[model samples]
Target: LALRSLAFQMSPQELDLGPEKVPGPVWGALFETHDAGAPFSLLVLHDGTAHLYLSTGGGLIGSHGLSEVSQASQRFMTQANRLHHQARPSQDHPLPAAGMSSFYFLTYQGVLCYTAPEARLGDGHDQLSPLFHLARGVVAALESAHHHQSRHTPPAR
Candidate 1:
């Protein structure tokens, strides 16, 4: 349903799914997007917690969550599990969020997989990916990361 809604809002082409390198159990993943200065973020915890946040230029608008057993949360788990099984994205060591925006995939083993320009969205254009329920702190961390990534990325020439 989330995927369908996203596909409807944008084109199906906007959605891309690939294998995770060194695939295994994931701790969680964060996705972010900005529109007209409004920052939106989705954080999915491995336990099936999904946190959704909408903030106004770094200010909080509202936060919502779906419980682990909820259908939405289950759907998110399914998606992450799919990535774990099929794509198995390479696990990279977590680096400082200093230079660029890289996709960070933290595994259950405490491994952090970092990929530059976060290939999950194809070619890092402005956009949002979908996920299930989680926590505010987690979401905030993700939003902060997104903001950091956005601020750090050198604008296209």
Candidate 2:
């Protein structure tokens, strides 16, 4: 649903899903043992700074943190280093607010996003990319899991 919503809102071509978005140290390869009571969800969004998760059957239950999550900072620095050489021609940008990696999650019909009004405001649409990225990633993961379960083949080994 999240991905669909994002897709509706913008084109996938504009979104970045490369390794930079979901780095190696983060989106684990482990099976991670299921809890078996109520299905849960976990993901790192916003260049991996924010951690998003939820565990509840109904009525909406979720949590998020703004810390670097180790992986995010590593990725951020790597990303910055890669882009440092590409100088902007004219437009100057104010630095974003001092804060850890921020993220937003949606649950039970509510959309939660983190925005620092005092922070750097780039293009009007920039603030929204994090939400769009998270939503799309989560939705795709969920759909893949569902497909794997339906097929009963262990999600392609």
User: What C-alpha lDDT values do all the predictions have?
Assistant: 0.39, 0.31
Worst 10 residues of 1 by lDDT: 4-13
| lDDT (tens digit, per residue) of candidate 2 on 1-157 | 2422232243212435344444332221100011333323334333432222333422111122323243443343333333322222222212123431222222112223343332222223444333334333443444444455469855555
Question: lDDT per residue, candidate 1, 12-110, as tens digits?
Answer: 122222223223355455444443444354545444444554443233222234332334444554555444332335433222232223333344443
State which candidate has the highest TM-score: 1
Instruction: Estimate the overall C-alpha local distance difference test score of candidate 1.
Output: 0.39
